[model samples]
Target: MALRLDRRRLVMGGGLGLAALALPGGAALAKTLLSASGFTHGVASGEPGPDSLLLWSRYVPAGEADETRLDAEIALDPDFRQVAARGVVRTGAYRDWTVKITLDGLEPGQTYWYRFIGPDGSRSQTGRARTLPVGRAERFRIGLFSCSNLPMGWFNAYAHAAARDDVDLWLHVGDYVYEYGIGSYAADDRIAERVVLPAHDHEMVALADYRLRFACYRADPDLQALHAAAPMVCVWDDHESTNDSWEGGAQNHQPATEGDWSTRRAAAVQAYLEWMPISEEPWKSYPIGDLATLYRTESRLIGRTRQADIGAAYREGTEAALTAFRDGVWQDASATMLGSTQEAWLARELRANARTTAWQVVGMGTIMGRTVMPGDALDLLRPDLSEGAVRSFANAARAGRIGLPMWMDRWDGYPAARSRFLKAAQAADADLVMLSGDSHNAWAFSLSEDGRPAGVEFAGQAVTSNGMEKQLGVAPSVAARSFVAANPEMAWAQPSGRGYMMIDITPERVGGEWIFMETVKARTSAVAGAHRMTVEKGRRRFTA
Candidate 1:
């Protein structure tokens, strides 16, 4: 059902500011100057379909009242000369004054402008959104983003992508907001003018804390511009809850100090749903004409098994025991990343979408390709490490003997799970294109199963999070060259760039362009580097 709206002209008294205060009897009683806090977070639209889109905004009442009725309108013109859809949504303190309404009955492949009006007649900034193209669409462009840590640097990637005219949809894989408190993760020297709000000074654990943290993140102008530019499809990763989170617990979350893991996880999910302009579904798939079907998967806090603890293994057992443990328990077949239900669903979708569409795109968190660090990679870094680092290097080299990957936090930890997904894609003969993030580095991998090409992956870099270069204490080019040389599956890598990925899909080919920002420490959207790669239709391999 469409939203009901009062057709009466809202009383306009003062311009812009809150003009009047209404009485209990639906009468204007007094006049008061109101701040523009009602639309402080701005408006966004998402979950686009051929005939529908969801609208969202955060409203703050002028007075002490906990609830307010706001009006929303969809129009064909910027001035709202031809109002297509009009409705009223009630927002209360329960949802932090956030209002989301799904507007349906719209034409396919059409653009629309929308805005929200507060009770006091304060209008929000106009936002533009469009529905998905129907039937044989010739082309579609998608902007991919992830790991937008506010304190680390400016959101130049968001700002850069918002200026593009070709993007039809934007996908944020995960880590939209960092849960770390002030002076954590990001160095103080690296933090420029951007500072988180006072209310979000501490790490987010409770519902209120998470809510405030999102509010702080959404307040950024660059991030807001990206939201208003195009329809967004978002998924939350570890930072939205806690770092390296699984189904039962997280790395950063301690049950004794942060309360129950379930409670904290629930709070984080709720806050993310309320803030993001997306549907309540944990995962969804979008069909772009006959060209592609985009599948958004949940890899964390859904069905993921406990990750391997190499640190614990080293501390508790001898090096020989650690090797045995890595060779045995670490490769447990029962361990899963997407669990059984989601895994089955993805397989079914791959087969179905492959038969119907030209491309099957898996939108997910973390890299899907195997990236085991070369055993000799440590040799190149020995000169850079301090005297105290010798022990750390020895431990890492010991683990490397048993063929452990660089980062257990990613798909490298779940080799069996990855194989299962790959096998399904291979069985379906799907031209799978995996779009991923969470490594904070740009990567392109030629993935295969059973010695046959199954798919290709384009993992985008972070918006502002520090990448391997920071941790390795090496130059950006050095890290990139080292990884690319070490792994045959990784065709290319940019281990230090902070930016987004631009994906263009056509019937004949799918192309990915890595747009590296000049410096995340500044506000400019200058380009530092860019690399493009393409895969031919049905080949499931990158073309030179």
Candidate 2:
């Protein structure tokens, strides 16, 4: 193993060796203190459709094994005076103390207020969410978000979107909650090592730890506000569980130490489903009045195989085991990103949407493109920076690789699946607009099929979590120039900033704006700059 035992254990959130029988920190104490106030973890709604929407909340009780179900009300007024729909959803540890229910029979494009009430009449905060309209929609606003590492900074982007009066939906590209140990993802200086509240200091495995972690992040007002503001559509990237996660395991997960991958993944997924207001499905599509069909895809966890290490594979020498591994593995058409079932389902969704919709929208985890790092850009940045994690990043300016960064574990890795999807898009003749996040930077590209324009993609930057600039300390201008110069398909990119992307659609074009924050150190940072661009209809190219 390139990484030693201690490294593995450390990566897995301390060690099973040190895990005595009971979980660290008193769970009883946490349960006694947890309550529902001001929405407590705040209120959220998601999975908007022409007919229904899903809303979520969490209420920890005063005793062990004591479940709490709140009377959730969806209303036309924020004051709850005019109720449109109401139901009861009970919270349980099986899903980590989170409660979510979908309210159907809602009018399209209409706003609704929702709150959860406990048995004692203690109520959660009232929040608003919207449903997609049917036929001929002129415009819709989405709160674009990615990478919300609590310690990096505040989720001001989420908060910012919520406070605004315009947003109709919130789109989280991925990294909703990082799965790293308290200090592994963020340095102590930025947010102290022991800062993780409810004390999930080690790797989280139990339901309680995951619940506590979500509580810690949701406690942020900005995140709460955003959840309060609009309906959300979410997908997972690697960090939501671990860096470079596959269906079987993760780069950061140590089975011997952190325990089983399935156990950890379930905990993460359960925690996420509980905390966020998204629906039960891993992925789904929403129809916007025949104008666009938004497809929220599931990339992480479900069915991703481990990535091939080409460099190492090439070094396996002449043995048959190595030869078999090296020869057919790279072109293993069997290996996949989305499992066969999902791929088929997606094709059906895309084809079906294309028949009636003007735009087929996809919200995914990674950038969908083939971008080989420019050796020239590498030469410039490597010499200027000291040898550290910054240099480590520069090393990705690889001499020659099979594809892109796999785009920070992107579509490029799953070549066969990508080919199938592109073919599906072409067959459908759909005006495909893909929204992606994961690189922690903004990107707009024209997807091509064998060099012909096939679709368009706009990847949003991070909300508050660090990007290449934060990790590498590369000057904004240098990083921007390096990437733009190297990547011709990249219409516009900001390698140094943290922000969200706005997609405003009409019949003729899809206009995208990168709403960057001045700072994320506080809950209410103002906009420093707004980069506006658009993907014109028929052309399928990003024209800034």
Candidate 3:
């Protein structure tokens, strides 16, 4: 049997939708002539807009010091026969030995290929790319994932997506890379606390350290394959900077041990932009015909206030945590998660999309809208929730009934911000759909305003990192069903599974499918469960 992609979408290479031809060598194949340190790292493209996309690659030159520009060529065909655009881009240490070139003047909804040539005649890999479709396009697809912790498991989810050639774009909603230096989150003797390439065993605090970490992650074959095949629109959640990060501080960040927050914060953002196949721009949007607008918003390290810690709720024991949460702090509008700036941006976009588009699609971190806990929707592992003594840390994630971490940590925590954004969607006369990560579980919910359903949310599961499964590993299936039975608003959720999500947006209705990994403990990427979730237009509700 042949190795297959999780989605079975991977097609063997060679000029997809275009003519196949051999690429011209600008010089001696430095891959042959420039030697080992050539473009060892490979190439990736991201942030596909209406007519352009950002192309990125890294090369370790052969010499000590010479400013050189790579003669880069991009075309609609693999053979470079139909060159859409060509240019010279400079790559150097200033940007951490990387090349960032924004290609322009191309037709919308087209597939393209790009390659880089160094001074010594070396070539980076032939990277694949595509543009968003033009006006009133009926349907488009997004491969969504989040919360990938390298030390925790293999990046099989990315690998699974890569083997399939179907998705037009990939949206990695945070935890693209973890900040924990190993052993911190995973309790293990063999996986010792990561001896970070940056001296410190705790958290990353410097540029070089941050760079090294990203480099190591980008080095993953699975992550590389996914980027190689699809254009990615990525957004950061807390883990990218620190655990449970807010405007002022973080759950894992310590000013004492890590020095100043701003410096560390900048270093994280800088490294992220430099290494990942994403732009340095904080937020952006991709216009998808007149059907909908994909609005990418910054949910962490920007305007998000300190996450609702609700220390009163979680003082150690799950029962105490439950008791405390029921007594107080589930809804505190005065305590803001998204500050004024981002809040305003989201509102305005919703209003604009509502006027003309069929749907307002908000791509972001953290679950949006409200989720009631202790209800069946939060079917965390009550039966054997303490399996391996792993408390329901991530169960509360998709819905969080145990730690109750200020449901505001998710959309539940920020009732006011959720209201403000949803109201904008309602006023825009637009059907709304929110794509979220950060919670690390699959969820489908209906968003309501003033007792009227306004939007629907489809939250993706983790790429690899452990989630509700950690707390309720004993009988995940039963727990999931129990949750659905309990939560009326929440149509469904998989508290203890890992996988990616796919969304198909059209004029009539918005549909979602959660593809659960067959098993994380195995190296092979396989789908455990493939579920269909649909939200009818104007109804603002999810159904099986």
Q: Which candidate is the best by TM-score?
A: 1
**Tens digit of lDDT per residue, candidate 1, span 276-394?**
99888877888888988988889999899888878876676477777777788778898898999999998988888889889999888888887866555555453656765655655
Per-model TM against the reference: 0.89, 0.87, 0.84
Alpha-carbon deviation at 269 in model 1, angstroms:
0.8
Tens digits of per-residue lDDT for model 3, 252-271: 77888788888888888888
* Preferred candidate (TM-score higher): 1 or 3: 1
Error of 3 at 362 (Å): 0.9
Residue ranges of candidate 2 with Cα displaced over 4 Å: 1-39, 61-65, 185-189, 192-194, 198-201, 311-330, 382-395, 400-408, 471-475
Give the alpha carbon lDDT tens digit for every residue of 357-441 in model 2. Answer: 8899999888886565655444445345656644444444542232334233677666667778888888888898988888887
Task: For each candidate in the order shown, give its overall lDDT on alpha carbons.
Answer: 0.80, 0.71, 0.70
Q: Number of clashing pairs, model 1?
A: 0
- State model 2's lDDT: 0.71
Candidate 1: worst-modelled 10 consecutive residues by lDDT = 1-10
